[model samples]
Target: MQTEVIIVGGSFAGLSAALMLARARRDVLVIDAGKPRNRFASHSHGVLGMDGIAGSDLLKTARQQLLDYPSVRWLSGEAVEAAVGADGVQVSLADGTLATARKLLLATGISDQLPDIPGLAERWGSTVLHCPYCHGYEVGGGAIGVLGGVEGAAAKAALLADWGTITFFSQGLPITDDEAASLQQRGVQIETTPVVAVQGEQPQWLELVLADGRHSAQRALFAPALQAMATPLVEQLGCRLVDSPLGVLIDVDAQKQTSVPGVYAAGDASVIGNITLASAEGVRAGVGIHHALVAEDSRPRPTAG
Candidate 1:
């Protein structure tokens, strides 16, 4: 199919970007595989004007609202490869179909490489969660646990303490003298034992076993998921990625245009903010793509030799 812009990953970012392009009367196609990282969360918070809404429902509403612009088309499919062309780019789909556009936006998003702890996946969106601001308040005033992941993760324990009594599980993560003193000053429980597994299936609170093989209980648990960039399409297009707090992210200029001429990235694929942040980024990216395309449109034609 022919379009002015092709946006991959149709959740918050892709959809929001598409909204702007569509409003500007551009023929935009959104190709999504329907796998959103936030699919597990029942309600999203901290997003201005969208607090207390389910993640899936918010996406559904965005897609429905996009229908007002007939220029936008939604497709439920995965994008596999992208190739640059004189006009713009050609994106290949998993089903062997081809789509062409003058510019490309990759909202392809990322995946959390969760540790191989049993029952974590099932409780991921529920009682066991990430992002203290997003999920902490709901699970507040209860016994909370933070599993040590990489270095500097002890900070997460202190952050969650605002909502409840906090515990730092340094399983195999030896606490230094200073860290122990800090926990004592803050009334935080310091457990240095390895977490054998979690107990309960629904809420699935961690049944943290201590070094002495004793079980320390927590009503709600927090563990940082190991995150990796979801797509190389940006790298394939030569976008330079620089240091980002969450990890490395594609470097985009003021227009959300990557180092590559006609490529853009938004949402979790580009920013590590919450859903509200993702949507806002997506809208900005969409507007940026519009200006980029307009500039290319208005460029002068070369004189015949």
Candidate 2:
């Protein structure tokens, strides 16, 4: 199928882009795999008008709104591969469907690679959380544990200081004397032992079982070692990527256009992972695409030789 724009990933970022382009009268097709990174979180916070809304329900509402714009089409499928040429960009799906478009937008958010601690995965998004701005307020006002030895771990613990009592589990991560002093001043307890397990459930609370046979009770645990899952599509399209403290992310300009001319990216794939941030980037990308298309069409034609 041919379209003016093809958006891969129909969650927040993708839907936001579609809303802008469709309202501008552009034919856009959104291909979604149906699994959003935030699907595990029952309700999303920090989103201005959408606070306390379930992640799934928010997407459902966005998709329903798109029904008012016939120019936008939604496809439930995974984008397996993508290629860009002088003519346009072409995307392939796992179902063998081929979609071609003048411009391509990738809102495919990165996947988080959680540490292999027993019981951690099961409690993710509930008792276990990430992003102080997103989950901090909800899990605040109690004893909280920040896991990981990375550079960002201490910073996370420091940020959560005001929310509640924080315990910084170094997890075999060597902490310098200064880092320890800083955390101590902030009322954060430093635990050098690694976490062997994360036990218990939410509402009832949880326990951070350590290797030293000491279990620490916490209202919630924060982990800071999120990594982006590798995707070959970006490489195939020749988009440049930059390694960040969080993980490798697609390098894009202020307008959210990637290194490739006709390719754009938004959401967790490009910047800090947040629902509100992702949606804003999507709007910028949509406007950028529209401006580029109009400029290309309005360019003066070359005179015949």
Candidate 3:
């Protein structure tokens, strides 16, 4: 099928973009793989008017809002490949379907790679988190532990001190004398033992069992160096990538347009992974696409002389 715009992901970013285009009377289609980065997170914070709302619920509301527009369509499958050619942007689905669109929006979010500690993955999003602003207030004023052995761990631990009493787990990561003194001055306890496992009941408490047969109880564990998994669909389309302190992200212009013309990206794929920011970028991309379409349609035609 063909559409004026095709959004690759249907979460916050893609849906927001689609809503804008659909409101402008454009035929938009959104294809989602059903794997939002925050799927494991029960509730999402920091989004105005939707604070503490369940992450899945937010997507459901967005989907329902899109259903109100007849010009918009959704596909419940993965977009395996995408290419731009004379016909336009062609996207192939895993279910043997092909979709073409004049403009394409890639909002496919990134995947976070956690540490190799036992029981950590299972408790991710609930007890173990990355963003202090998102989950900090909920677990605030308690004993929080920062897992070491990764870059920027010390700084993160120091920053988190305001939220609670911080315990920096070195986890076999070397700590210099000066660094130790600074952390000690800030009253952040430094544990040099390795963390063998992370076991806990989420929203209540967590225990980090150390290799020395000791365990530390904390309200939450923060990991700063979680790696982000690249999106194959975006790579297949040959989009330019930029390496930031967060991770490798899709390069975009002020209007969220990527390196390739007629192709745009937003959300966690282009910027830091946050629902509010992603939704805002999606709206910008939508407006940019609308203006581009209007300009193209209104271009002057050569007179027959």
- Which candidate wins on lDDT? 2
Ranked by TM-score, the better of candidates 1 and 2 is: 2
**lDDT values of the candidates?**
0.82, 0.88, 0.87
Summarize candidate 2's per-residue lDDT along 1-305 as a digit string, tens digits. Answer: 99999999898898999999999999999999998989988899988987889999999989999968989888998899999988999999999999999999999988888888889888989889887788889885889899976777887788789888999999898887778788989999988889999989575799999998999999999986566844568878889999889888999998889999999999889988689889998999999899888988899999998
lDDT of 3 at 155: 76
Error of 2 at 74 (Å): 0.7
Can you write out model 3's per-residue Cα lDDT over 68-142, one digit (the tens) per residue? 999998899988889998767999999999999998999898878778889888888888889898999998677
Q: What lDDT tens digits, residue by residue, belong to model 1 across residues 50-135?
A: 77788888888889999778898888887888988798899988999899999999898888876677667777878678888898
lDDT of 3 at 134: 90
Which regions of candidate 1 are displaced past 4 Å? 174-181, 204-206, 210-212, 243-245, 303-305
State the lDDT at 122 in candidate 1: 71
Candidate 2 runs further than 4 Å off: 302-305
| Winner by lDDT between candidate 3 and candidate 1 | 3
Residue 183, model 2: lDDT of: 95
